[model samples]
Target chain A: SQQGEEDPQALSIQEGENATMNCSYKTSINNLQWYRQNSGRGLVHLILIRSNEREKHSGRLRVTLDTSKKSSSLLITASRAADTASYFCATGGQKLVFGQGTRLTINP
Target chain B: SAVISQKPSRDICQRGTSLTIQCQVDSQVTMMFWYRQQPGQSLTLIATANQGSEATYESGFVIDKFPISRPNLTFSTLTVSNMSPEDSSIYLCSVEINVRQYFGPGTRLTVL
Candidate 1:
């Protein structure tokens, strides 16, 4: 079964705008990871937030985790057209369960 | 993070034929994962490729349809047997490091 579910299924924004995506999961997990996939390409690890950690940052990306709520959110600041892709949230356990994903489109 | 590479970046095969997709990591990794993403669908874990051991497959996936091989820490392969149109999807290989997981470029398979 899929553990995570991302909200807003799709988001359209202009370049330089900030984009936010939310993910909710059903199980207790050790960590939650976010990944981005370009068209016809593989997934690239964007960020990871551990259960004990509330927030983390990497360059333009910020991830916040709320284990109590079983949810997480990814914030991309100053988004660009190249950022258009499918973003997924995966919860780690014996195996990782990925969210349905949110497709973000940055209009140039 | 490890640099992962997959062979046969993409392929078009006839139904009933089998194709093996190979993944090679630049460095050693203890755990490797295989995933399949159907068109416009989320990724599903295929199996956990443990070096020198039989792979652990996910529910709804079996060793028969998708056979996995992990010869060592840096190399693994997944084969799609008796391919059908439904088997066409993007196959990816992944490995984790310091809590972050990296994926291969993926192999795009099309069965007709």
Candidate 2:
């Protein structure tokens, strides 16, 4: 069974707006990672945060991990039309277990 | 980052037949995994491909139904044996590089 539970399965926002997606996992994890898949294609690694780290940023992506709560959030700032894609949060390092993804649509 | 590729990006196979998807990594990797993703669904881990050994399948998955071969560090193959319509999904192989993971272009299989 999948261990991660994600919220807001779908979201629509205007270009330049900020988008946030949350994921909560049932078990303790050593790290959490985010990935984006476009048009049912191969996934692109977005960002990964270690359990010891609270937050990390990469370009327009900001990810925060709260190990105490076993939850993590991904924030996309200044979202662009190209950011329209399905995003998933995965737990476990080598044998990753992915959560049901959040579909984000950036309306231009 | 690792460069991974899977052959026969997509295929339509007849029921009861089998299809083998090959995954090749640019560099040698210690860990490789296979996953199945149904339409608009999350990825479900099928098994872990351990080099020079049999794969470790997850719950509900077995070696006979999905036989795997990891002949070396940079190459692995997953075969969907005696496929059924329910096996229609995107099969992806990924490699773990330096604690990070990289995915290959998925092989979309449709068992008719």
Whole-model lDDT values for every prediction: 0.92, 0.93
Q: Each predicted complex: what DockQ?
A: 0.71, 0.87
Task: Put down candidate 2 lDDT per residue, B1-112, tens digits, no spaces.
Answer: 8999999899999999999999999998877999999987999999999897779999999999999999999999999999999999999999888777899989999899
The candidate scoring highest on DockQ is 2
Model 2 reproduced share of reference interface contacts:
0.79
- Residue runs of model 2 more than 4 Å from their true location after superposition: none
Task: Choose the strongest candidate by TM-score.
Answer: 2
Interface RMSD of each: 1.6, 0.6
Q: In candidate 2, how many Å is residue B46 off?
A: 0.7
Return the lDDT, model 1, position B30. Answer: 88
A1-108 per-residue lDDT for model 2 (tens digits) = 897788899999999999999999989999999999998878999998999999999999999999889999999999999999999999988999999999999999
Report RMSD (Å) for each prediction in the order shown.
Answer: 1.2, 0.9
What tier of docking accuracy does candidate 1 attain?
medium
- How would the docking of model 2 be graded? high
Q: Residue B7 deviation, candidate 1, in Å?
A: 0.6
